[model samples]
Target: MKKIVYAGLFTFFVSVISFTARAESTVGYFGFEPDIITNYIGPSSKKMGYVRVTIDLMLTDTSDIAVVEHHTPLLRDALVEILSKEPEEKIKSLTGREEIRAKCAE
Candidate 1:
């Protein structure tokens, strides 16, 4: 009985550790969500006007959607760089929305 209990306990611990070792990042793990600015808020928003952008980002192994709250700037920067010169037409339009989603998925 004692040997059986020890064997079962050992198996449980090993399985638990193995499960943790196999985690994978989901599409939402890009660390941040895209932000669309429709209006400025003085010095806080600077001279930037309302614009839409799609951000495609690489995800860190441990990142998730929740981390987006902390990485908003990163997402905006990436989107701006990739989708520059057409923020208004690209982000606000229906086609742009689809493009944004496609880019983000990749």
Candidate 2:
């Protein structure tokens, strides 16, 4: 009985450790090329200021890095289109910027 109990405990511990190691997330940061995105702010009569944005993507698993990099151009174009639609005032405010970012995330 004693031997059986110890063996069961050891097996449980080993399995638990193995499961935890496998379950751990492998995180990676991927930066799209041409890191800086520069575009003129929305409809302004006077000299329109340009907004420069730097975007970096975080992947829960390293495998996603390739997938995201492959779609970089599409991501950039979408972001540019979204920003271009926003008014100059929206780009200037924190809330507005957050809203824009949320939209891009969606």
Candidate 3:
């Protein structure tokens, strides 16, 4: 009887510890309230194009979500500024799009 109780207690403790660790390591995602929309330079000097993007930030820990929420406005503005400066060709091409994504990640 004592051995069974000890085994059960040990299992419960291990389960609790594992659950806590998993919770702490969980990833969190935060999305912008309104999609970012901005105008970019078109193929020709006389033309102009606009792009709309929805961005979601992935955080390493769920607790960091609040920090991201607090700075959402600034993050949206920065993304808009980055997109607005891009040329139409870069905005449309795959490689260019990847580059833009990398820039945004930075």
The candidate scoring highest on lDDT is 3
CA lDDT, every model vs. true structure: 0.57, 0.81, 0.90
| Per-residue C-alpha lDDT of model 2 across residues 11-39, encoded as one tens digit per residue | 99999999999879699898766755556
Give the candidate order by descending lDDT: 3, 2, 1
Candidate order, TM-score descending = 3, 2, 1
Best-performing candidate as measured by TM-score:
3
Error at 25, model 2, angstroms:
2.5
Instruction: Report how far residue 39 has shifted in candidate 2, in Å.
Output: 3.0
TM-score, candidate number 2: 0.68
For model 3, residues 1-106, the per-residue Cα lDDT tens digits are 9999999999999999999988767798998878888999887888988998888888988899998888888888889999999999899999999999999999
Poorest stretch of ten by lDDT in candidate 2: 35-44
Error of 2 at 98 (Å): 0.7
| TM-score for predicted model 1 compared with the true structure | 0.32
Model 1 poorest ten-residue lDDT run: 36-45
Residue 102 CA error for candidate 1 (Å)?
1.6
